[model samples]
Target: MEERRRYRRLPIKLELEINSLFKQNNDIIKLNNKTIEVIDISKNGIGIMCSDNFPVNYYFNAKIEFDEERYFYCVVKIIRSSKQGNKYCLGCEFVGLADFLADKVDEYEELLNKSQIY
Candidate 1:
């Protein structure tokens, strides 16, 4: 398969908590407090492996905590999903990624890459 992503996906493990999943009417359909593992991330989207088969095209808010005070939050829409053994791998795109948030993700990716180089 060919690579279609605009941004490079930085391979890193980050814990994210699903705050809420919304419906078309903006009503919350699901509330998840469990932490999911973010397999990879980029400026446009993130890949996560979780236990639930989240509905494709569904919108939700996720909170990612890099460290003590560094937290990134965004509204993401599920673009693709596939089963991986006992888990489900989901590809989600940021609905409206802010410039500051994009910068934060970029910085984190650079730092993560730097640490892996040693």
Candidate 2:
């Protein structure tokens, strides 16, 4: 069998405020509604570990609380999910993120770079 290729990820962590909604039957339940730690972030999306599993293609709004001076929102699309021991790892694509949020991502990336020096 051929080995599957994995996506290359950046080695950086960022704090994000995420609220995910999952549709159940005819109702919508909030699968995760709190602040989550973003393990890695890319131009297209981000990777986070949450407590529950959300269906692929589910849409959710993410509020990234970068610092005391910055906070922004983004529309995320669930890409892949996997259970790692007890926690669930979720990969999502940023469908439509606000300009302010995109700026925050850039700032957060810079902060991550600075943190590595210490």
Q: What TM-score fits each model? A: 0.85, 0.67
Please provide, for model 2 over 72-110, each residue's C-alpha lDDT reduced to its tens digit, 9 standing for 90 to 100.
Answer: 667777889999998889988888665565666667667
Q: What C-alpha lDDT do the candidate models reach, one value each?
A: 0.81, 0.68
Model 1, stretches more than 4 Å misplaced?
none
- Distance (Å) between predicted and true CA of 63, model 1? 1.8
lDDT comparing candidate 2 with the true structure: 0.68
As for candidate 1, its clashing pairs are: none
Top-lDDT structure, candidate number: 1
| Candidate 1 per-residue C-alpha lDDT over 1-118 given as tens digits, one digit per residue, 9 for 90 to 100 | 9998799987767877776677677667665586678988888988999998888878888776667666687888999999999999999998888889888877887677788841
Colliding residue pairs in candidate 2 = none
Worst 10 contiguous positions by lDDT, candidate 1:
26-35
